[model samples]
Target: MPNQTTFTIKLETELKDAFTKIAETEHCSVSQVMRDLMQQYIERHEYKHFLEDKVTSARASIANGQSIPHQDAKAIFKTRREKV
Candidate 1:
């Protein structure tokens, strides 16, 4: 395992109690639950930005008339599958 770092965090009583209950139900420590939740939150935010960039690029492409027809897309996929 990589080296671990420690930091102090404060949570509301109700939120702390809720996390404790979930940790108990999941057979894990509260710290583990918080760590997993934070990891998932970070990944989700990253993916959101990634998708936003893709959408922005696609919109620019459409505005510039750089697009393929639906049938053309289907034919391209069919040819790719056949090649594979």
Candidate 2:
């Protein structure tokens, strides 16, 4: 296991109680639940930015006339699949 660190977080009493119940139901500590949720939030935020960049790149490619028509692309892919 990696080194662990302890920190304090302030939560509303209702939220804390609800999360404690959730942790108990899941058979894990509140810290584990918070860690998992934080990790998921980070991953999803990163993926959102990744997709935004890809969309921007694709728009630039289209503007620069570097993309094929959708029908042409479909035909190319179909031919390749048939050859296999």
Candidate 3:
């Protein structure tokens, strides 16, 4: 956590207590659990958005008639795979 900054969030007392209890049970700080959860959430959404962007670009390419034939694409892929 070099170059770390403090972050604050509001939560209900009960929820905070529950989180604290779980953190103690696991012998880790609440911050660690929250960081892990946040990291997972960020990764999941980023991957989802990346796929969405790819689909949109593919759709645009098709709309503009800028795509190779399926067979041609497959042959290119096979050739490249063999070269590896």
The per-model lDDT (C-alpha) reads 0.91, 0.94, 0.96
Runs off by more than 4 Å, candidate 2:
1-10
Please provide TM-scores, in order, for all candidate models, with all chains considered together.
Answer: 0.72, 0.80, 0.68
Q: List the residue pairs that clash in candidate 3.
A: none
* Residue 8 lDDT, candidate 1, scale 0-100: 78
- Candidate 1 lDDT over residue span 1-84, tens digit each: 498988678989998888799799989997887788899999999999999999999999989999998899999999999999
Off by over 4 Å in 1: 69-84
Question: Residue-wise lDDT of candidate 3 within 36-78, one digit each (tens)?
Answer: 9999999999999999999999999999999999999999999
Q: How do the residues 1-84 of candidate 2 rate in per-residue lDDT, one tens digit apiece?
A: 399888788889999998899899989998888798989999999999999999999999999999999999999999999999
TM-score of 1: 0.72
Off by over 4 Å in 3: 66-84
Which is superior by TM-score, 2 or 3? 2
Candidate 3 worst ten-residue window by lDDT: 1-10
Candidate closest to the true structure, highest lDDT: 3
Greater-TM-score candidate between 1 and 2:
2
